[model samples]
Target: MSGIYPFLTPAGDAARDARESAARELVRSTAAKAVESLELRLRVLGTLGPALAACAAAMATAFRAGGTLFAFGNGGSSTDAQAVAQVFRTPDRDGGRPWPALPAISLTGDAALLTALANDVAFDVVFARQLAALGRPGDVAMALSTSGGAVNVLRGLEQARRTGMVTVGFAGSGGGRMAEERLADHLFVVPSSSVHRVQEAQTTACHVLRELVRAEPAEA
Candidate 1:
C-alpha cells in the first residue's frame, strides 16, 4: 500500500509547496505596495496646506446653503464618484456626533441616460449634459479622473462652472488639463503616477473633506 501510494510522496507535494510559496510572495509584494502608496498620501496631506482647507470650506458652504453635491467621472473614476456619494449619504455610525447626511448624487448612476446622451449627442457631453440638466447655482460638483485628461470629465467640470456651480476635481499624475487650465474652483492632485495609488489617495481626501465640512460650524 505504501509503495502504491508512493510513500505519501514528497514529489507529489512539490506543486502545492511551490504554489503556496508564490502566493505568499505575492501577498507580501502587494502589501508593501499598498503601504508605500499610503505613505505617499500621508506626505501629501501634510503639505497640501491652504488648497485642502479651501476645498473643505467650499464643501461646507455648499452644505450650509442646502445645496447638493454632484459627482461625475468615467471608468474607474465613475466608481470613485459613486463611492464619494456613498460616503456622504451613509456615515459609519460609529461613536461620534450624529451628523446630518449630506446630499450627493453620482451622475454616472443611470445607464439609460448615459447611453441616450452618448447616442443622441456626443460621448464627451454625457456628463456635461447631465450637469446642465440637474445642476443649479450653489451646487457643488466633484469630478474624478485618474489621468485628469479625460475629455468628458473636463467638459463636465466646465459645464458645471458655466451653470454657476462650484467645480471641484480630484485628479492624479500632475493633474493634466484640470491643473493646467484651472477648470474647477478646487482641484486636488494625488501625488502618484500609479492609478491605484491615486485612486486610494483620492478616497482619503474625499473623506477628510467630508469631515471638515461636517465640523466647519465649530471652526467658525
Candidate 2:
C-alpha cells in the first residue's frame, strides 16, 4: 500500500516500516483530536454568553464587597482549580491592561491541610470543613469537576450555599449530580464525555469569565 514514507522500499526493514506506519497514525490521530478539542472549546464558549455573564456579574459583586474566592476540584480538575485561582489572583500582563490582582484561593494548594482533613475526617469534608472555617457570606465558590460529580466537590458547594457564598461550577458529561442537585448558582457544563475536551473547554470558559468580570463597570 502507498504510505507517507516513500523511502520505505518494499524490501526495507519490516520493523522500521511498522514504526513509520504507527508514527503516521499517531500524527493523524493527534491532529484530529486536537482539532476536535478546539472545536468543542469554541462551541462551549459560544453558548456560554448568558451563563458566563451572570457568573461574572455575581463574582464582580462579591469582589466589590471584599469577598474572596475559593476554588477546588480533584485530580486533573485540581490542577484546573489552581489555574483558575492563579488566573484570577494574577491577571495576565500580556493584555497590557494593567488589571489589579484579585483575591482567590485554591483549596487544593495546601497539601498538609488537605491531608490532615482527609485523614482526620472523611475525604468528603475536606472542602466542606475548610469552607466552614474560611468561607464567608458573599464569597465565591468555584468547583471544577469534569464529571460534575465529586462528592467532596458537591459537599463544598453545599457548604458554600449554606454560608451564603455565590456558587459556580465547571462540569461535564450532562452536569451529573452537580446539575441534578442544583448545587451551583451558575453551572457551565461541556456536554462531552472526553475528559480532555471537557477540560479544554472549561479552561477557556474560565478565561472568558475573568474577562467578563473585569469588563463589569464596577470600581475595583
Candidate 3:
C-alpha cells in the first residue's frame, strides 16, 4: 500500500503542530489555575489559625454552658451548615474514651418551616424567624456565605444578636458585608474569590473548630 499521505505543504504541517501546541498550553493553563486556587486556599487556612482558635474557645465555653449551636447558609453553603451540625452532634470515639459534647442544629434542615416562612413572610425571614422561636441566650449561631452577603444569613445573624447568641460567620473575599458590618463575634474569612476555594477552606475551618471543641474535657 502507498505510504500514508503527508501534509499538502510544509506550512500546513507547521500550522497543525502550532494548533496542537496551543491546545496543550490551554489545558496546562487551566490546570495551573486550579492548582493555584487550591494553594491560595491553603494559605488562607494557615492565616486563619488564630481566628479559628478563638472560635474554638468560644464554642468550648458555649458547650460547657449547655448552649446549642444553630447553623444557617444559602445554597451550597447550606450543605456546609448541615455538615457542621452533624460534626458536632455525632460522637467521636477513639478507643474507650468518647470526645466532648457538642449540640448543634442546622436551620436549613426543616423543609416545612422553610417553605412556610418563605411563602408567608419572605425568604430572608426563614432563619431569622427560627432564631426568634428557638434560640436562647448563650447559644451560638454559625452562618456560612461564599459571598458573605446573603440577606437571609444576615437576618439570622441579626436575630442571633438580639437573642444574645454568639454569632460566627464563615465568609470569603474579605468577609464581604459580614466583615464590614461587624455582624459576627468570630468571622473566619477565606481570602479567595473562587467559590470552591472558599468552600474547601470553610470545611477545614469547621472540622478544626469541631476537633478543638472535642478536645476539651466534659463539664462536671
Instruction: Name the candidate that leads on TM-score.
Output: 2
| Each prediction's RMSD to truth | 5.5, 4.3, 6.5
Candidate 3 has its poorest 10 consecutive residues by lDDT at: 1-10
Cα lDDT tens digits, model 2, 22-71, are 77997999999999998898889888888899999999999998999999
TM-score of each model, paired residue for residue: 0.88, 0.92, 0.83
Top lDDT hit: 2
| Tens digit of per-residue lDDT, candidate 1, span 58-143 | 87887788889999888888998998898887755436777777899999999999999999999999999999999999999999
RMSD of 3: 6.5
Residue-by-residue lDDT tens digits, candidate 3, 2-62: 1242432235678678666766887899899778777876786688878888788887888
Task: Rank candidates by TM-score, best first.
Answer: 2, 1, 3
lDDT of 3 at 146: 96
Worst 10 residues of 1 by lDDT: 1-10
How many clashes in candidate 1? 0
Give the whole-model CA lDDT for all candidates, comma-separated. Answer: 0.85, 0.92, 0.87
In what order do the candidates fall by lDDT, top score first? 2, 3, 1
Indicate whether candidate 1 or candidate 3 has the larger lDDT: 3
